[model samples]
Target: MPSNDSLARASGNVKWWKNANIFQIWPASYKDSNGDGIGDIQGIISTLDYIKALGVNTIWISPMYDSPQIDMGYDISDYESVYPPYGTLDDMDQLIKGCHDRGMKLLLDLVINHTSDQHKWFQESRSSKTNPKRDWYIWRPAKYDADGNRQPPNNWMSCFSECAWTWDEHTQEYYLHLFCVEQPDLNWTNEECRREIYRSAMEFWLEKGVDGFRVDTVNMYSKPMDFPDAPIVDPLSKYQPAGTLYCNGPEMHKYLREMAAILARYDAMTVGELPLTPNTKDVLDYVSLKDPQLSMVFQFDLVDIGRGPVDMMKLTGYKLSALKAIINKWQTFIEGNDGWTTVFSENHDQGRSVSRFASDAPEHATNSAKLLAMLNTTLTGTMFIYQGQEIGMTNVPKDWPIEEYLDVGSINYMKLIKEKLEATGASEEEKAKAVHEALLNINAVGRDNARTPVQWDSSPHAGFTTGKPWMRVNDNYKKINAAAQINDPDSVLSFWKRMIGLRTKHSSLFTFGSFHLLEPENEQTFSYVKKSAEGDEKALVVLNFTDQAQEFKLPTEDGANWSLLQGTQPVEDPTSAPLKAYEGRVFVNFGARD
Candidate 1:
């Protein structure tokens, strides 16, 4: 457990993730408890000890709520109910109780941006415009283009693909679904909707002693009221509409403050999955403790490796200066501010960290992965570690076709490919390659990479389940698995154990210390120093984002030699002694130049 003093020391200011390291568990693939071939609360309960052993103080589970499962539970039919397939409410209760018993905290997914179309609330809203619940969703009267053709109310594009509007014959209007048609966006403008969603949903779990919430699609709550047609970016963009009109609306801060007030009653940790580019500071300002909209916001810009928007060709490219600038801004923003930040390289939505950020080559992959872990763990912010990250998982197989693609973003991109091909009169092969590359950009590094069943052993299912899993497990399980790495001191899993243990051990140095970026100009190699009032600490975070090892000079304090803190490929060889490919080193600054 982390020391109380360290937590308190780090608390007066908002940046909680700084002293904390959280492990994310994607339930469906973690471990199945009931021979039901799916993971449940019982499965999570079984792994509590294992998670505790890893030294992580918190666990953030993906959604396991009642849902159509159309979008893997993102389309929640019941915000307060647990999915029967995953487990009963009792199971969640027991798990929460058990987590508390083991001194671990639990964070549930907060998917309030939209609700499943099948939800009772949606059913009521869609029944008739005159119904009491009709105002619960964002439904608008249909408008006609110059051609007099019936069209959606606005040019709102779904994050999954094109337009966010879904035509409903009964209502004679389109309901908004920022992601999927099945997941209709709720109407925050409705007072009842806002109160019910926040108070009821929050109180449900807070009553059960859940400690925090991980908000989903947080920035999509507010939309433009104009409901006007959007200018065409792509004739197909007619589908998504002008998202800017609805995204980060002027009243978003107002709604957030309302929700924050309720969350504060229970002192629940609030983390928003804020997707923003220019509004980084503005977003933080809304959620900082001073305003209390939330406790923290996740930082994904570092992991959003695509050069612009979602381009695959630049996925492997490194912009050290850009990456440094991003982190530096975040560090400065939350340093003395009222809010905090959560650190991560990969998650259920991202490709495996080693595969996406690090080279897949065995010699360098795991090292690169570890270097990523070191950078976050030492930086002045909280950290989130995804499942299988500890063991260095890679992206999924590329053989999966459109039929196998389950993620909406991937499928939508597939549609876009076909459209582009037809519009440009390209060959079938060209179209397929374009779609595949786009898929590679979105889900290729591996949509299912993090979704692969947990590798617990060399046996079948890697000890994840006794029966077939909903998703396929990685083929490399035979060689790279929990059983094989648990005892290996040099294994990635062991290194993570070290990373977590150190944070808990040196909370004073790791959590409450001041953070400063060493270089803001260099783009490839990231270096920073974490300073404290009593003493200064430095860590040279050198990473080879490229495929090969490159020689470079890094500043080191005289007598403050660098040591391999946690990394893959050993940095012991003479030529690579100073730096290892995909490796990260933490050096203690002893003062004076080398």
Candidate 2:
């Protein structure tokens, strides 16, 4: 629960953001009000009521800026302007105000590690060695190894695969980009670049009343002078090792401190995306509770936990012990510390939580929604809701053609899976599995799955647009959409509302309370308890991971009067209570069933 002191930071009774459960919106797929087939700010405004009804208090939008679209909107050309594909600057202003009017905060996507080649600085730097902006980008002569032939600066590889350094004919050297060839990483070594970026673009959003930022690739600011080579892992990981040197350099904290100092000046809420750092242990030092350098950090451990060889139908059954261990690893890191964790199973980059955790079948999807929500909502961390997640979106169809595919990571994995399938000695069934693996790699948790337009109604393009949508809407829009659920008491949206309301009413016990793991031995279920500073213990989170009903044995001291809070089924006595497969049980010490 929020303390009287932290809650006191409110401005004139502004105690809103503290209990806010945020949702992430990828603009391209939300809704297109102008009928141009692209979801715009106007379309989002039209759906505000739908979102507000989901018990959401904060919205985090992905990048929607002036861009070359080389890597989507991440390769930004202009910093402060809204892209025409989305809307005008006025549209964004109204969107922010619309959110605030409904008691919600909007956070912008801050992608600063690299800029589009069209950025003025990159343009000037590429012009010539004598250009004023030459130092703004890292440029160096090609190095020759004992093997012979000019190589990229160090053995550094790009995060997007291949070499991180791109040879520029004009400069007669290489420029670095941790992603695509068109996005050259900025040289943070230059003080001018840092100040101008923060003063102009970074600080501009906050000044515009934007609540906070989801800092994209913020930790890849400083790189080692000697970019070293990484030991090869996958046979297909031909990518260079830019991370060996570019990620988490010695000055990482210094730069983050500088950013924290600058953003602190404006009191902005900043969360970082650390691709290289998945475990909470990796970022524990700066992001603890007492001294949070970042408001929270997105650790992709659970998101990437299913990864390995892509066997389509094969499940990496996380025996309950391992799952508890993973959760315990994170819980203990935050045990005596102040840094909090951000919880979410699905996001723009990953497959839907329902499809990934539970079965993708509709029945399973429904259970996963309630089950996962019960688990994460009670953990000692901040909860984030991805758009359409509350309604229980599933992964893309396996039959989606190659043409429908997007996302570089999926593409890399698909190519590898296909090559393995083509190995001549494989049997027909084996070949089919290989192909299935390719589809899984492409659709398992691929971006395109989440990029599908939000299912708003049964109308054309799922009522996302009157015009042709930029991306195709799911065919199941008729059966699943916001329109049908908005007023339906039994709709998934309605259940989500209840879930959030329960959390809000019990914020003190859920938000700041320390987490304690229970029943670590059971593979089919997870149980945990949380207690706050005042010893106001009311939070008890339990989840069922399997399809069959399972018994939960709670620790002795925690055996208190309990009542069901949220679940597909109801909670009975844990000792004899058998929860249906994938069903969840959230309970409070209400002196009912125990």
In each prediction, how many residue pairs overlap at the backbone (N, C-alpha, C within less than 3 A)?
18, 18
For each candidate, the alpha-carbon lDDT, in order, equals 0.72, 0.73
lDDT of 1: 0.72
Clashes of 1: 18
Residues 1-594, model 2: lDDT tens digits: 434433332212322344568899998888887878887888888878778877778899999888887776889998988889899889888998999899888989998888999998899999999998999888889888798988776655565545678899987999988788889988888989888788767788887788888889867888876666665654444453445456677877777777877777776777788766655665875575345457777776677665643232234545667767777776557654445567777788877777777776766766677777777667655688888887777777778876677666566546655565665568889888777766756676677788888888888788888988777677677887877887877667777888778777777566555567877897777778765534544556777788777766543464576555566564456435677788766666642221
- Candidate 1 lDDT by residue in tens digits, 138-186: 8887889899998777665676666678889987888888888899889
Candidate number achieving the greatest lDDT relative to the actual structure? 2
Per-residue error for 10 in candidate 1, Å, reads: 3.6
Question: Scored by Cα lDDT, where does model 2 land?
Answer: 0.73
- Where does model 2 exceed 4 Å of error? 1-18, 145-148, 235-244, 278-282, 289-292, 309-317, 415-435, 552-559, 570-576, 590-594
**Ten-residue stretch with the least lDDT total in model 1:** 1-10
